[model samples]
Target: MTVSIWQADGTQPVREVDFLVVGAGIAGCASALFASQAGRDVVVTDARDIALGASGRNAGFMITGLADYYHKGIEQFGHAAARELWALSIKTHDYWRAWAREAGGVHMDQRGSMLLAESLEEAKELELAARALNADGIEAIYHAADPLKRGYFAAVEQPWDGSVQPVELAQAVLRLSGAEFIANNEAYKVEQISAELVAVHTRKVIFHARYVMLCTNAYSFTLHPYFRGMVIPQRAQVMVTEPLPDSVIPVCGYSDYGYMYYRMTHDNRLLIGGGRHKFFEQEADTTDDRVTDGVQGYLDGYMRRFFPEVNARVDRRWAGTMGFSADGVPLVGTLPDSPRIGFAVGFTGHGLAFAAGTAERAVDHLLYGTHPGALWAGRLTR
Candidate 1:
């Protein structure tokens, strides 16, 4: 699509682009990069700076597999579908590794991850997951013995999965994407100009493109009501503690079905997040990114319980909004009403794990008219 602006002196300035991506988070940045690499004229815009949202505020674990446990995923979607989703996550992890290498190896650390089992029942579940994963040729080990000093009964270790510095990764993606970026440009409205064009209006400028991809995630509902109930927003609180003398957490870890996750940073600071379940009612359907006392208290309690040896104080605390679908899966496809506009949101809190592959699939649908076989395709409209 082509956009023309009439200057005060009656001169016309025109800009044409093939794809316009909204939101500068991981999904949006990845979309822009893929489109540009495919020789498409792409433009990316964000209301805030890159990685200021959930993309930056997450626990930094580059995990493989679904947000839901593998056993639960098999129960919900069956084995074939669950396997596909797991495969997709592994592909995303490989993509990040390749991208990081190409971008001078920034923000990526290949330290494997473990899912802690707080109870015997949870350990059985982990054992079931490990079996299913190994059956599918994915390596997984169930550690019946406690590997860490924490009081977890058992753990499921995925040696292939790792962690990344989320903010640094986002910055590297934006810098290496080679797409025109307009930061601090908040898109207020999106209009389908025609079957072949979409228009995005920000406070300062109106962007026109042949195709528009919305990667807004949590803020999607604000831009369009179509995603209101389908893609609900939830606030996730995170806190980083003062650097300790020794590393307490050897590997990235999560427990309680990923409701709580923590990892020791390279600088020996414990960066922990999660606990929305404690304040589910207040956190659900809200875009507020402020850390609430209730959730913060829960996180603090978790830290004290898990790392009692470290007499560290919370150095920083913040919150970020994450979109969640009825199912844990993300929404990825074109909007039913507007085929020219595509979206990839509702990743729950697994954006970092799913963003790259999700963006690539969405772009494939947009560019080549291919059908996306996303596990949640049934939940999302065309």
Candidate 2:
């Protein structure tokens, strides 16, 4: 979100608004939606247009939990918090589905998703995760053997989770938000002019607003100094193959502890992503959204190792940045220096899994001072 001296020169037009939401991605648009619903005059502005960021570039799995398995999540954040995050994921999916129904033209396939295990040890973990989820009345099937017969060991099938058109869903939410949307506007800096007014200096305009929600996600570090180390950027590489004559993957498939994922797109093309863990040094702490040969080569090898039967040529390749929090969960709270400037960032590559619900809590916490449990930013300090 860098602005050159030649671009703005600090002469941008000044605009007044009730609530200003930065980053027109899922979290930002969802923030705008919730804030407007709460009777605030909200405006959403972005460096890029709606759905042009990570929200549009995802594989669109409406997975009903964090990036970790249920048992792993329990280990990381404790049982209660893990359950709450799962519930949040479900609630977020519900919001997206409702928006899909309301807006139309969005495709949602209800075939569900499978968490495949690449090794025997991972298979055992999958079984444990399935049992943990089932104990909590979360219906997940444990398959002892690889269902796809793609040389994987085992899997946990979440029958309720589904794939979606993420970009379409984002657009639908934006339209339903009813907030004025300004595109190609990058917020270079933000300052609290007073207790009641926050000045958001952007490339195209400066906003004087009572409240501002920074849903900037991966690019959060650039807007304010406070975001440094709070939200780290991780780049994700993805590829889609030409439409196959037959579907290679029936459900959204994840394997290698989520280091690799493949899903059948709506048009019958196979979309593959991940491979970042192998090239961690290159992928971490970078906002550059360029496809790397190392990761893309990894995806190529992955496709060959698992789905060698698919001979269709790769049609497209691209990359996007994901915001990883200090903890792997989202960060929801207002800035200590400026309480009126709130934020919900750090989805940890689970933006589709957490954005809507996190945004909902962020809005509630910002406008009503309600505590956003599990993802409270105060926990980072403690």
Candidate 3:
């Protein structure tokens, strides 16, 4: 079933524009804002509402670089290409610092992140990876967290990482006065009207535009058949605890890399998420965000095992769906030289950290006909 947090106001697109972007997630909102600023008439819409999918439902961690370490990225791509990707990811992160401020301070924290491992061998690999990332200018260090001495793992602390409320950040960006946001409306089809015009079909209306950008992330399967083999949907589970007493649990940081992450909210509630890969086949759809006993049981065990100091009950449980790509990187670019078809999707669950910058660059390519930062564009062009 589709999930909605914002009701659509009575606004329908009855006229033509320069651009129409589908999917109001981070990338869509970013594209809408940039395209509008570029003097292109722009309209942004989503299937349900803004920030309703992975945007609102993620755990909100912002660790630097891709899901893999520097060495792994090098292994996948060549050394020079990997280095450039690393530098660009870091640059995008720095750009995020300024973008957040422009979007009215989007709740970015610098509380750091810890990478834990269960075995000594895994710890050695992490240490080696940390060294390589450090050499590549990433500030990751091998430090065994005190929490892990109690059996979490030998860990590495990346000082530049932190968390945020992703949906709120996307909403703040959408508040830009120049962009038109259409909520509760889904894009049913895209038909080219002419060389300079295209039509975006919703359930009720067909909106016309000169350009169409697909920033729908995992939901792009309906529009792009290639995404089926490139990007696979993965569901992540999360739980938030009731606000504990101030001194009871000094809620400060976050843990886990691609799985098993938790952070303390401003209200003093502990929000934790992970454990979808544990039940791989069952989590590939955009269905119920409700938690299951198997996943919840693991989360409960994680709490008891790592955070035994604060024996708090789970106030609420929920799940969020994220797209995991085959090569573990986002795909952002035009649909093979089609002037009217631009797309930014397949984030593989870590798009929140760099989505705005990625979308901005993608829209720049759409507007200028070529991207200045060819490295970022090429990295995501897959």
Please rank every candidate by lDDT, starting with the best: 2, 1, 3
What is candidate 3's CA lDDT for residue 72? 76
- Candidate 2: tens digits of C-alpha lDDT, residues 1-382: 7899899898878999999999989999899999999999999999989988889988887878887788889998999999999999999988888888998989987788899998899999899999999999989999999998889899989888888988888888888999999999899989888988999999999899999999999889888877799899999999999999988778899998888888999999999999999999999998888999999999999998998888889999999989999888999999877889999999988887899999999999989899999999999877
Global lDDT of model 2: 0.90
lDDT of 3 by residue, 1-382 (tens): 2322333222544567668888888778878878877888788888889889888888777776677766777888767766765665666566556667777857877677777765676667677778887787767778654444647556777767777778777887777725787787777667666777777767545787888888887777666565565666677888988898853333233334446777787677887777766776777765456778988888888788777787777898888767776677666666654667777777777786557667777787777766635323345434
lDDT, candidate 3, at 125? 62
Q: Identify the candidate with maximal TM-score.
A: 2
lDDT digits (tens) for residues 11-65 of candidate 1: 3233466899999999898888888877888888888878888898877888887
For lDDT, the strongest prediction is 2
Per-candidate clashes come to: 0, 0, 0
lDDT of 3 at 155: 70
Candidate 1 segments whose C-alpha is farther than 4 A from its true place: 1-15, 375-378
Q: By the TM-score metric, which is better: model 1 or model 3? A: 1
Order the candidate numbers by TM-score, best to worst: 2, 1, 3
